[model samples]
Target: MILQDFIAINEKGIYCLYGDFYLDPKEPVATAVISHAHADHAVSGNRDVYCTEATSAFMQLRYGKNAALTFHILGWQQQINIGGVEVSFLPAGHMLGSAMVLMVYQGVRYLYTGDFKLQPDATCEPIQFCQADVLITESTFADPNTAHPDAGLEIKKLADIDINIMLGAYGLGKSQRLIQLINQHVPDKTILVPHKIWPLNAIYEKFGYQLGNYQIYSRKLMKEQRQFVYIVPPFTFDSYIRATGVKRLFASGWKNLQVNDKDTLYISDHADWNDILKAIEQVSPKEAWTLHGDGNALKQHFDGKLPVKIMN
Candidate 1:
């Protein structure tokens, strides 16, 4: 069977024609096989949503009553039938509950990798791969020149700062991961989390991933503490751009987010070019399909080796 005929990208998102379900649809649809609970991938209003248990919890936490009409929670590697197609979830390693959707129909397998990473993270499950006939992957950091440094080493950079740090990070997955990294690498420094992110931390803890030694943020704590890291969401971080008496830093993989030369922390959750190459090699698909970022580099890299298609 042809791969595109099984699943193809449309105006909404990647649609699985055989299963009659959308994979991370842009808008609400009858059925959505969510890869994760990130706002971009897991939207509210779907009639039936299939995802990991943690992903369901996060969606409920973020969207409340509007999460979804029905949630079909699946454990890692657990397979279910959806419209005559067999579907399963595998760890994506990008964040807690993140997964790569694997669908099989008529003995042909297609793997849809959402945002994923190969970097070792203490807070979430590591990525796993399976052989497939067609591999659909995200190329967020697919440039051959782009390589993510060791995350543990990057977190250690915080140890050098003697004063309080105003660190900006995404409130969901990124913030939780940062909390654990700081606790593990720079044990001496205190980690302060804002109200916006505290709930997410609790959710992570509920899933049995212990995030060591962090307190809810307070002005009193900020005034009394020294050598502490104040983690805030982007909006709060931006508002405090000119705040005095603390060192400013943003934790991200994107170079553009690192505005300060001396205070940049290059910790990223997405896979770099090498990691993407490694995933493709492990999956060993007959053909490769790329999405989410520019796939020209991948296409060129596999020009004579493998057939690579850039999905719009």
Candidate 2:
């Protein structure tokens, strides 16, 4: 209850009144504690930004040199005081450098899961659990019907096909994951990415996420008859599919899309419904609040179990 008084959702983002910092704020602020380098969570133009080293590098890659007024990099479990409140970052497991913001005020701990996944992803750090009085989480796939299948199975399908496979993924985290998955499952096939994703691969490699054998896409290679796995951002998928005449697969968690029968892979980086439930059970917070996506399902499912609120 006291923590509720200290933290509140504002127009910019979740604000810590006592700490005077914002958690993954949307707009610019004096001090921003970012969860990850995803554009939706870690926006540019904040006066001061705090995040993990990987996230800082990601920010630099995405936002350029002038991403923030100043940067304060924090390691996992490394605590720093701001406005007399102890704050730290924990691994989120969503992607490389993704983290959960933890704040301790007056001996009571509060944890915020910016965006996380329980499923294993080789391209990033594993999720770290921390107990807290209040738990704030993202409900991207909170619905009971939403469940992700094994990502390895999906990758295996791409390997079995005879023709070249063209996969569409979000450029930031998802693209890197696909590269690793493709390499692990079908090491023989050549893995190729568009120009935009090439730089991201370098960053991932710099952080020790070895994405085996891969190269940037080329028009000359496209003309060749050899089977190659081409991964591109969603925006460019349609163009590449039409020009290259390759089998297309979209990797995402959404199940109800009108994609072709064998063209969609239910591979997601966000925690599914069961994962959400497990996280709540693990945290055992006095109060639980959900944000992002449609959180009504989470509120309804945990109705009498805890004090659950669907945050807008």
Candidate 3:
């Protein structure tokens, strides 16, 4: 029972051979064990899907009847057997309902993290770690120099500006997070969201995470309110690139998405370099495997200390 024999990257996604399921498959498959409902990770047309209750709700909202033929909802830490392999989910802290897949075969544990973060977020569950023989993780911000600043301080930056703000964020996780952050830190500024994002917010609220206050976007309402933040999805934000008056800012961890020095909100849902290292330390895996971003730095850092493999 080698690590590769248990689970390895294939054309579809991170395939669990022992379980006969795909973790976050790119294309639809027979059985998909989704970590979250994000478009890139959870796609439509899968015959069967296994994920958290919140993830299932999100997928239904996003994909409707096309979400999946069957959704096998599993609570956190709940164990199930598939293809003679024991499987479970742990909080990933990346977003609401995000999970780190755990598979055990022949007494060896393999943990597959599907995008994760270490920051404290009121809108989502915090990450939980467990010891494993092989640790597979996403290295989105795995550079030695990449360290995400405190999200609280970053969100407070919105309070300094007195003008209306056109805040751009992803609809599912990021949009809801920004709404909560603005309500808690920048209460003076009214929060506005587009129609597409409103349903997702409702879903979050249904899950008992209260997002303070927000209204669906309105051109007239935006004009009436002087101190307000209008949060729009990426597509809407791009369409309004030339629109006038409001200060344009995109909330993301990527430096390139910042566009300019002033129009940047360094709020990211992905784990940074230090967070990744901390995760590895916490997991204490015999061998580390990296995906999603460059793994050379991790490989170099662990040279002679612990074996590291870069999964393509």
Candidate 4:
């Protein structure tokens, strides 16, 4: 039987039948091995949750302090035996505590990469490559035309701005990364963020990331019409700051973002088509399975090179 048969994509998520564990299960399950703390990837109410130390903390913060779930902290390179399978975690370089899971069953190695990027991010651990027999990966930005510029170069676009810039970002990973990037690249600029981002920022700093001086956005402060960089969740951009007249900038990898009078910075945390192919080449997987986003690009790219399956 093929190694791919051991791991199947069910409605719940990618399930490892032999090991009796789920990788980043979308719904609550008996045993869940989470890759990161992103809402789509990590959820609460699982009987058992397996993830890195940082991911565990993120889960607590996201699910609330009193979340009733069994936690298992799996450090990088720490291997454990579960249901007759050997499993371990590796750095994914996507966010503060992102990870790539490796499972070995019956001498065949299978690597499941949660969301990941090849670029450097001082905010989190770097991506680590390893050999695997079968590789299951995310294809968020897997189009051949998609290419991300250097993170520092992308963040530097805000340095020359003179007006108070209203930056829209996801409150979890992107907000923290942007804060650190601005601090490192444009230190002179004062940064302001919505109250919602405060707790996540505290967690990032608690994990030893040094984000520069930033204050919570106040209506009084916004009333002053001061020239400062203000970051807020994308969803709140319209209602929260409706009356405030500020230059808008969005930091994301999507090429064709439709925002009125706003500049889109192509900064992404997922690997593009070339990088996806490169990662697969590095892993040298005999078979590949693609998930997340539109997996067509990966499937077409590996059409004849190796057997590829698009996981539903």
Candidate 2, 60-122: lDDT as tens digits? 888886689899999999999988889999899999999998889998888889999999999
The segments of candidate 2 whose C-alpha lies over 4 angstroms from its true place after superposition are 240-244, 256-258
Q: Is candidate 1 or candidate 4 better by TM-score?
A: 1
Of 2 and 3, the candidate ahead on lDDT is 3
Compared with the true structure, model 1 gives a TM-score of: 0.98
Candidate achieving higher lDDT, 3 or 4: 3
Model 4 lDDT tens row, 1-312: 356578888999989999999999989999889999998998888988889888888888878853326898898999998788999999999998899999998888889999999988888899998999888889888888888889899888787777778887788888888888999998877789887789888888898987778998776676575467889887776555454467777778876542443466778888988789889999999988888878887777778989888886
Model 3's alpha-carbon lDDT is 0.91
Rank candidates, lDDT, best first: 1, 3, 2, 4
lDDT of 1 by residue, 31-117 (tens): 999998889999899999999999999999999989999999999999999999999999999999999999999999999999999
Off by over 4 Å in 3: none
Q: Each model's C-alpha lDDT?
A: 0.91, 0.86, 0.91, 0.84
Best by lDDT: 1
Measured with C-alpha atoms, the lDDT of residue 275 in candidate 3 is 94
Candidate 1 residue 73 C-alpha distance from true site, Å? 0.8
